[model samples]
Target chain A: MAARKPVFNQQVLYDTTPLPDSIPKVKELGATSAPLFSASFFIGTRCKDYNDDYMQCKTENPGKGEFECLKEGRRVTRCARSVIKDLNTSCLEQFRAHWECLDDNNHQLWQCRPAEWNLNRCAFEKLGLEKVIPDQPPQSTPVHLRKKMIFAHYPIPSHAKPFITGQEEAKPKAS
Target chain B: MPQDMPPVGGYEAVQYKRNIPARGFRAGYYLAGAGAIMAYGWYHLIVGLRERNELAREKMWGRIHLIPALQAEEDRDLVRRHLADQAREKALLGENIKVYHSDRYVRPTFAATPGSTTK
Candidate 1:
């Protein structure tokens, strides 16, 4: 069989789109929580890593059998698996509860709101994520509308504020 | 001749040799069996090695991620500080920075024109 083209040679990096608000935002907790949105992300990223390793191995050892490149490929795969397993182990209880609730509620966000909140709360407290604060008090509105409006008006937390504020503090113009 | 009668001259007894040569047949069977066993063993050896490598990689990566979970409060705090520093440095460098375009706002390029297709 003709040698297959290496995946890395194709400039298609894995999708970097942020997870939709509908799915849980566990990764927002930074490196402490799951590195990516879903367990599948872990698998995909790891697969990419494995492919990279395999390609590198092939380039270095042309005409070698699959067994020759197995060493590096396995290393990458193991690393990815471990990262996923760690995340699961760390937050399995909350993750399970959130998923089960979604399953039970037919994936209706409004119905699973409580479970979602519970999971977020657990992640925030345990994973060192920045807590988002609303700019104004919540208004009396439909649950879905309220959620949308709340996020719309949410301001960055002080701890997580960006270093660059376009308006520099008035320091007398540097002489 | 009556239907049930034996050949008229005599009941001549004839013998036939074995259809297959026993020596060759036995040798072929033995070779085939050995080949099959070797193939099976080779297949399993490859699979076992693959599995072992996977397990090892998993363990290695797991420990890296697990560090945060297993750290003491002070260590965790240090990690958080390190991350904040990294973010600040990146912002300062401003490498490959892209302008943020909010979905709420429509740019001329995005606006639909008469007789034009919307993307």
Candidate 2:
């Protein structure tokens, strides 16, 4: 494996302008891509309604959504930041390990399964965030829970217990 | 002048030997071997491609599963920045003046701003 160079996102565009005094202040998420990807599903679970609402607002507002949907958009940002903050406080070790692994492996999650497994368990136990792939076949095993990853360069079978239980692939019932 | 007749001792027993009948397998056997190897290589190539495609699908879906949340997060940031810009304009100009002629909520851009001329 040709080792990839560590690429941390150092360039952040800072808007010097301030929000109107009327708008409530909320800090933007500081977590970059790898960390965000690591905690993405948790963010989805915790902030799904806010996210969907924001998206719906945008769709409804059409060309005016950017300004018109500011309220919903703020909700999305606050919720995601809170999820990241919770991850930092509760599962910092596993979270760091997973995101660092993701960073190292060009953000291919399968390559960092063991670290991800640790983080997922921590998140589910401590934060109630589950990594559920919506609309995937119910009978099939999830990629995250697989015993083996065929494409991984260094396939280490994770021995960690699943955060969510009873993923035993069920047979199709004869209707 | 004598039609180039052999001169000495019948030219050392005609000085020539046959091609030794190509001491190897016949053309049919060689073709069969080559065909078998090609077939095996093609089979492996197909299998390899299938495996690669499956991996690609897995990778794609993995990202797909996270896109909604990521987009929402990104959209939120843009909204915040634009709102901040609106506030700054109201503070400085006493009201939010329209950048464009018709009102449309454009994603945040400094293109219309004087800052575009600066670094």
Candidate 3:
């Protein structure tokens, strides 16, 4: 058979686009869960390799595992499970950190503040996220007038909420 | 013998036409192509089935072999941990030899089995 090029190698090399959001977020935090592995299956079927290009690194110089890198001189390593576990734990830790940060700043509108959004900035040097408190009167209209304005803009029936409530509370028929 | 009977030469020619090998060659080619296609299909089907069987075997052995071998749930949990450890070692560390397997048909003979042996 004539030598055919592989499907993956045919793509353009240097076409730059914005990186994906998930990868950066994952990297920033780190996981904490136990790694669930499908590496052996990959090795048996897809990769057909015992090299460094595999996702995980070997413990010894050359390991016997499917995902282990082939060393220049030594035995091959074989530990797909541990590598997956590490990855999971790291990801979970990262997620937990991000979650905690967000939880701590429950009232903050902006998550990351770099001490820049102000004119009298020297007086307020504490670099923290801004808190957004809702306006009482809103400086736009009174409660009734605002309600009327909203009703004008988006005209749902006044009794629509009550009707939804009734529908939710409605019981099943006997049959 | 005058009008009803055909000439022997014409009858032989009709027989020769009926006995031509072209039909046999076509049938042979058709059967060969069909066989090749069927074999190709069967080869992939077997491979898929084998892969599934291997996965099922791993699951079964994990439950039957590893679980029962351990005493406590903690020990079983340790084995589960070790399975991941083995997986990681296999993947990253290249330590595939987590266990051993023997050939199905091979049987070992002990020396002098209830009878005289020459040693």
RMSD of each: 27.7, 8.2, 28.3
Residue-wise C-alpha lDDT for candidate 2, range A1-175, written one tens digit per residue: 3376222121345554555667667677777888888887788788888878887887887887756776777788788889999999999999999999989999887788788878987887788787776655556566676656666888675455444443311222332
Give all candidates' CA lDDT scores. Answer: 0.40, 0.71, 0.29
The TM-score leader among the candidates is: 2
What CAPRI class is candidate 3? incorrect
Error of 3 at B108 (Å): 43
The per-model DockQ list reads: 0.01, 0.22, 0.00
Q: Point out the higher-scoring one by DockQ: 2 or 3.
A: 2
- The TM-score, computed over Cα atoms with residue i paired to residue i, of candidate 1 is 0.23
In order, the TM-score of chain B in each prediction is 0.35, 0.70, 0.36
- Model 2 pairs in collision: none
> How much is the lDDT of residue A83 in candidate 3?
29
What CAPRI grade goes to candidate 2? incorrect
Which residue window of length 10 is worst by lDDT in model 2 chain A?
A166-175
Tell me the tens digit of each residue's lDDT in model 2 across B41-97. Answer: 999888656555554555565564355555555555565567767767788989988
Candidate order (TM-score): 2, 1, 3
Q: Report the lDDT of model 2 for residue B22.
A: 77
- The window of 10 residues in a row where model 2 chain B has the poorest summed lDDT is B110-119
